[model samples]
Target: MTDDKIQELIGRCAERDVLAFEQLVRQFQSYAFALAMRLLCNEEEASDAVQESFVRVWKHLDRYDRGRKFTTWLYTIVTNISLDRLRAIKRNRRLFSSRDEDPSIDDIQDERDLHEIHSNEELAGMIRALTDELPLKQRLVFTLRDLQDLSVEEVSEASGMSIGSVKTNLHYARRRIRQRMAEKYNVERLES
Candidate 1:
């Protein structure tokens, strides 16, 4: 939808128009859920985080600044909620363990279709698994900028980080992902 249309929806939403809110939700829900999934590294938690973020957005609709890009504001809300959920889950796990854990392929919900980003199921699984190895900041930067195709400025604004920080995090994220993918490829080659 165009910015003008979204602005109209936001205006209506601020007035408590349920239908307008639904329209906005329908437009953005998939992307928001995708982002949350990448950030939390779990399907169920991502769904919950998106739901909670939308609820918060609904409650604070009147507080939204019309001067800003609505999607950027929406991303900010979703990212904050997902990060909080991630931190809470991590904290609980840390309380019960003495070491950090890496998410395995089994933990990721594979939903890629043949026409989607990656047609190779095995490669898709490897990418998802390797993504979980990044630090939280790096993961968010990589997901927003590279996966979601947001510009550096948009990612910086959405993530509430400086442009330089976003660039730095994205640099580290790409480097780590490349290193992990290469290592995995080498292992599979050797096994064969």
Candidate 2:
């Protein structure tokens, strides 16, 4: 959907128009759900977070500034909600168990020729495992910058961090992931 259309929907939504709100939800639900899934790592939890975030968005529509990007504002809400949920889960897990083994990074190397196929689900799973090892701030920056292909400024805005901090986190996150991949796959041959 176009920004103008989204803005119009937001305007109507702000006025308590139920149809416009429904339309807005349909337009942005997938994007929000994907983001929540990436952050929360479980489909059920992500769905719940997405639903809650939308409810909060509707409740706080009047606070949304028309001058800013609507999607960005919506993302901020969803991301914050997902982070809170994640933190709560982590806290609960810590309280309930002493298990500390990290999740295994899935093998992502493709058996097919690199030029023929770009299946990266395994790679994505590995990346996700590595990402899970990162601190929340670094993980958020890395996901937004590398996975989502957002600019540093956009990541900064989404994460409420400075551009420098975003850049730094992305740099380290990419470096660490690459280092892990190299160790797992044999760096010299892969490079060649």
Candidate 3:
């Protein structure tokens, strides 16, 4: 939808129009869920994050600034909520030490050779798994800029980082990811 249309929906939503709010949710829920999934890495947590984000949006519709892009605002909200959930999960895991830790890059053993992987999905999964090794800042920058295809400025806005920080983080993230991919797959042609 165009920005104008979204602005209209927001205007209606500010007036407590349930139908307009529902329409807005229908239009953006998938994008929100996808982002939450990237940030949280768990389907159930992502779903809960998305739901909580919408509730926050509903309550704060009137506070939204019209000058900013609506999707950017939505992304900011989703990113914040997902980060909160991630931190909470980390705290909970620490409290309950019996939980199985997430697998490390060394733990993933694939029988098929890299060349035998025919689908982009499989390649993406491998790369995503490697991202788990990255520091949180690097991982968020990589996921937002490379995986989510957001521009540096957009990533800065969503992640609450400066544009220079976004670029620096992205640079380091890509270098680390490329290094990991090369070590694991023994393929040196991966682009930076």
Candidate 4:
């Protein structure tokens, strides 16, 4: 949907129009959930985060600036919530020590090779797994840039970082992904 349409919806949503709110939810659900998933790395948590964000957005709809891009503003909300969720999860995991650690990439070579023969979904899953190895900022940058196809400026805006930081994080993310692919899959393409 276009920004104008989204702005119209937001205007209606600000008045507590249920249909307009539903329309907004329908339009941005996938984008919101995908971003949450990338940040949280858990399907259930991502789903919860998306739902919670919508509730928060609904309650705060009047605060939305109509002059700005609606989707960008919505993304900022979901991204902040997802980051908070991630931090909470990390703290809980550290407190409980309930989750077993994953094996190193080298140890998962056989599984990685098998994953390579599958469809793009499998490849995406492998990439997501590799992303978990990256630092949080780098992972967010990579997901926003490579997966979501956001521009550097958009990523910088969403991440609250400078454009140069976004570029550097993306560079490190791509390099790490390529290095992992080479080590695990024996694939040697220069371009990802």
Candidate 5:
């Protein structure tokens, strides 16, 4: 949807117009879910996060700044909620058991062809798998900047990080992911 249309919907939503709120949800729900899924890596949790995000959005519509992009604000909410869900899962898992073993990077054969990775879905899955080994901040920055295709500034806004922090995290995140990818598939070089 166009920014103007989204802004109009937001304006109506702010006035407590239920239909406009519904329309706004329809317009952005998929984007929100996609982001949540990338962050959470589980469909059920992603759905829950998106639902909670919309609820929060509805409750706090008045606080949304008109000058900033609506998506930036929405993404901020989703990122924060997703991070909370991740922390909760970690806490719960810790209560139940000891730490999970790290996947053996040594199992990846060096001769696998990168060209064989044809589907975007497969590549995305591989990237997500690689990201599972990253620290939370690096994963967030990498997902927001590279996977979600947000600008650095937009990632910073969404993640509530300083621009410099986002860049630094993204640099390390990309470098690490690329190293893993090369080790997995034997690529000669990867661009940062």
Candidate 6:
């Protein structure tokens, strides 16, 4: 959908037009859900987070600034909600664990061959393991800036991090992931 149209929908939402809000939800729900899934790593939890996020958006529509990119603001809400849910789940898991099960890196299913645009899921388990090993901030920054293809500034804004912090985290995240990839695949990454 066009930005102008989305803004129009937002304006209508601010005016309490339920249909407009529904339209806006329809336009962006898939992207939001995908982001939620990436963060939460579970379909059910991601669904719950996405639903709650839209409700939160509706409740706080008036606080949205028209000058901001709608996607960035929307992503901010989704990321925050998903991270909160993830933290809660992790806390609960640590509190009530029996046998320790290590979810380590493994091989991937090589499907599509993506070019230098960035790596694709050559090995799904390996990629996920590499990502999961990252600290939360680094993981979030790496996913937002690289996987989601958001600009550095956009990721910083959506993640509520300073631009410098975002860059640093992304740098570390990518370097680590690449190192792991090299070990797993025996391909040296050229330093850029």
- Tens digits of per-residue lDDT for model 3 on 1-192? 988899999999999999999999999999998888877777788899999999999999887999988889999999999889887877887788633456445545743433444454444455447687687889888888887888888999999999999999899998987787678767656343
Q: How many backbone clashes does candidate 2 have?
A: 1
Candidate 1, residue 76: lDDT: 94
Give the C-alpha miss distance for residue 25 in model 1, angstroms: 1.4
- Give the Cα error of residue 90 in candidate 3, in Å: 2.1
The best candidate by TM-score is: 3
- Report model 2's TM-score to 2 decimal places: 0.84
Error of 6 at 133 (Å): 0.7
Preferred candidate (lDDT higher): 3 or 5: 5
lDDT of 2 by residue, 73-137 (tens): 88889889988998997798788864444344443344232224233344335545668768788
The TM-score measured for candidate 6 stands at 0.84
Q: In model 4, where do residues sit more than 4 Å from their true spots?
A: 98-125, 190-192
Score residue 169 of candidate 3 by CA lDDT: 89
Off by over 4 Å in 2: 98-102, 106-124, 188-192
lDDT by candidate, in order shown: 0.79, 0.77, 0.82, 0.78, 0.84, 0.79
Query: Which of the numbered candidates is closest to the native, going by highest lDDT?
Result: 5
TM-score of 4: 0.82
Candidate 1 per-residue C-alpha lDDT over 1-192 given as tens digits, one digit per residue, 9 for 90 to 100: 999999999989999999999999999999888778767767778889999999999999988899988888989999999989988977877788633355453444432321244533343344457666678899889988987789999999999999999999999998987676455443223221
Q: Which stretches of candidate 6 lie over 4 Å from their true place?
A: 98-103, 107-127, 189-192
Please, what are the lDDT tens digits per residue for candidate 6 over residues 1-192?
A: 889999999999999999999999999999998788777767788889999999999999988999999898899999999999978977787788532442444433221221222322233333356687798899899878877788999999889999999999999998988787677656464334
Weakest 10 consecutive residues, lDDT, candidate 2?
Answer: 111-120
* Model 2: per-residue Cα lDDT at residue 89: 78
TM-score, one value per model:
0.80, 0.84, 0.86, 0.82, 0.84, 0.84
Error of 6 at 179 (Å): 2.1
Candidate 2, residue 10: Cα displacement in angstroms equals 1.0
